[model samples]
Target: MILIAESGSTKCDWVLLDTLNDKRINTKTKGLNPAILKKKEFKNIISDNETLSEYKKEIKKIYFFGAGCNTSKTKNNVHSVLNSFFKNSTSIVEEDTMAAVYATTSTPAVVCILGTGSNCCYYDGKSIINKSISLGYIVMDEGSGNHFGKELLKAYYNYQMPQNLRALFESKYDLSEKTVIKKLYQSKTPNKYLASFAPFVFDNKEHSFMETLINDVINLFIKNHILQYTDELKTVPLHFVGSIAFHGQNYISNQLKKQGLNAGKFIQKPIDSLIEFIKKENAVLQS
Candidate 1:
């Protein structure tokens, strides 16, 4: 058996693949990002996952694809926590971007993550060979949940938002831009706070301004990040993952095709491909 984890900035998806039977049981736990999660949150997630102790003991390997584990320092921190619990198992840690590649065919393609945060890479199959900017939450993370939320708040404060949408925002958050600013600037885990408004975008999909807002952000991500990976303007099959990619796929994919980039498959979560990968790989090991 193999244990797998795919973590974004906000949460993680876990699966225990019983290689022997080719069955995968799914579970979800808290986020595990070095940049976003403190030691307590990280420890908590590990504890809850280890609650599957029967599976934990039976599992032979653990593969983690975690966001914000970009540096050796970050990777080691998450590794330390995971290793403590899965002591009998082997653990492999890689950045969340690589997980997207693994979620895809592990081929030479553009693998993107559009979620709480957005980032892109040109996966040469063997490795994610190169990646574009993930300039943190402030300047980048375009085409992300937080990005959508930020736009929603902007429209609300600027009075450009439609009345119905504005009312929803008022009802949900009940905070003015000034209050939001104070909270965002003065709070901890500000990214989570920013992402809080993302639901409003979906709730207000009928509003033209919301469409424009979504389009602008998705376009910026394609132009800045995806385009940067284009090799001599040759179109590459771009695969997308995460909730933002799932929800805003039409707008995001159209914008990419408009620029002559071939938009390929979009998978909301890596769990399916990950299970398949482990099952297939484990078969070879057994044989």
Candidate 2:
């Protein structure tokens, strides 16, 4: 059996393919990004033998694509967490951007991930040659759901929001800015709290404020994240994965086209492409 996962800060999608019978069991797991979960915290989640039996040990091989699994330190931390789950399974872990590349097939392409956070990588079909800055939540992460959510909050609290939008924001989220602020500043995992605002953006699609926010997010992404990678942009076409990128596809495509850059393609999920990746790899092994 082969166990594969696509993890963002918010959640993880797990697919366990039992090759012998060609059966697959799909599951959803909690977020295990080391950037968010410290080593001790991760240990408790995975090593909590009380619930391990539910996950089972039928998996023989494992592949993980995740956010915060970028640096070796973080990767090892995440690995330790997952190692508990994939106990008898051979696990290969890599950054979430690699999943975009593997799913997109490493063409001369720019892969953008816009879930809780954002990252852009230039893939050559063989390697991730370049990656633009993803300075986490405080600095970059422009064009991401969290970024849009944060902007919406600031607009509401700063007395800058129109009355209609302000009312909608308050009624929808039902969260006080003071509580939000304390959570964002004082919590162990602030990004998770900040990302919680994404639903507000989704719920208020027709609001002019949303349109402006989208435009601003797109502009900042192109300006600071994409165009900033001057040396790499010329090398490939752009492809995007994630809920926000897929939902805001038309707007993003139009924006990039306006800049005369051909945005490659967009997909709502990576599971299909991932299955294809495994099939192709299996073929190569057989050959």
Candidate 3:
């Protein structure tokens, strides 16, 4: 049996496939970013996840792609937790950027991730060659959910938002300055807290103010991430991965078009494509 997982700061999606019987099981659990959680906490996260516990013994090979898995220290910390769970299974840990590359296309392209967080890289059809330094939500993540959510909160608090929208925001959430500040400063997952407001933007998308806000964030993303790449990398189409990019396809595409760039595929999740890639590679090996 093979278990493949794709995780961000918010959640982890797992696909457990029994190759011999051709059976597949899908499950979801809380997000586990090694950079954020300590080894003990990471272990607790896996233990707390009911799905992982049930499939713990059955899984023979584990492929984990996650945010914050890029660094050697974080990778080792995560690997240790997985190793403890599936002692009999071989585990491979990789960064989420590599997952995006394999999920999108094999050809060279500019790959961008606009999920709970944002990241961008230049792929040379074989490997990631260059990457924009993701300064996290506090300073960067320009086009990410948290970034947009922060902007929304700013507009609402500053009294820049239209009255109707402000009323809607107050109706849906606690717009109290104290609550907002507490979440921003004291919460363990502040990014997720901020990103929770993105749904408001998506729900109120038709409004001109919302439209302009979305466009501005996307434009900044293009300028800071994609446009910073060399001309050669920019020649091909730019691809996107994550929920934010997938749902805001029309707006993102329009923004790219304005800059004379073509938008490539938008994959909301990469585990399906990652599974297909592995199966194809295995089939080739057998042949």
Estimate every model's Cα lDDT from 0 to 1. 0.79, 0.77, 0.88
- 2 versus 3: better TM-score goes to: 3
Residue range 1-287, candidate 1, lDDT tens digits: 78888988778888887766768788888667887677667877677665456566676788888889888988888777777777778888899888888778755787888888888887765776655546688888888888887887777778888887777678888586687877799876677678777877866667788888888988888877888877823745778998889888888777877887767788898878877776777788788
Q: What are the per-residue Cα lDDT tens digits for candidate 2 across 27-128?
A: 765767888888887666545533334655766677888889889998887677667756887678899889877777646777888888888877766777
Candidate 2's C-alpha runs over 4 A off are: 43-52, 229-235
lDDT of 3 by residue, 103-220 (tens): 9988888888999999999888887875556668889999999999989989988899999999989999997889988998999999999999998998999999999999999999
**Which residue pairs come into collision in candidate 2?**
106-125
Candidate 1 lands at a TM-score of: 0.91
Comparing 1 with 3 on lDDT, the higher-scoring candidate is 3
Instruction: Candidate 1: give its CA RMSD in angstroms.
Output: 2.2
Worst 10 residues of 3 by lDDT: 228-237
Q: What residue pairs clash in candidate 3, if any at all?
A: none
Q: In model 1, which range of ten residues has the least summed lDDT? A: 48-57
Please report the candidate that would top lDDT against the real structure: 3
TM-score head-to-head 1 vs 3, winner:
3
Regions of model 1 farther than 4 Å from truth: 176-183, 232-235
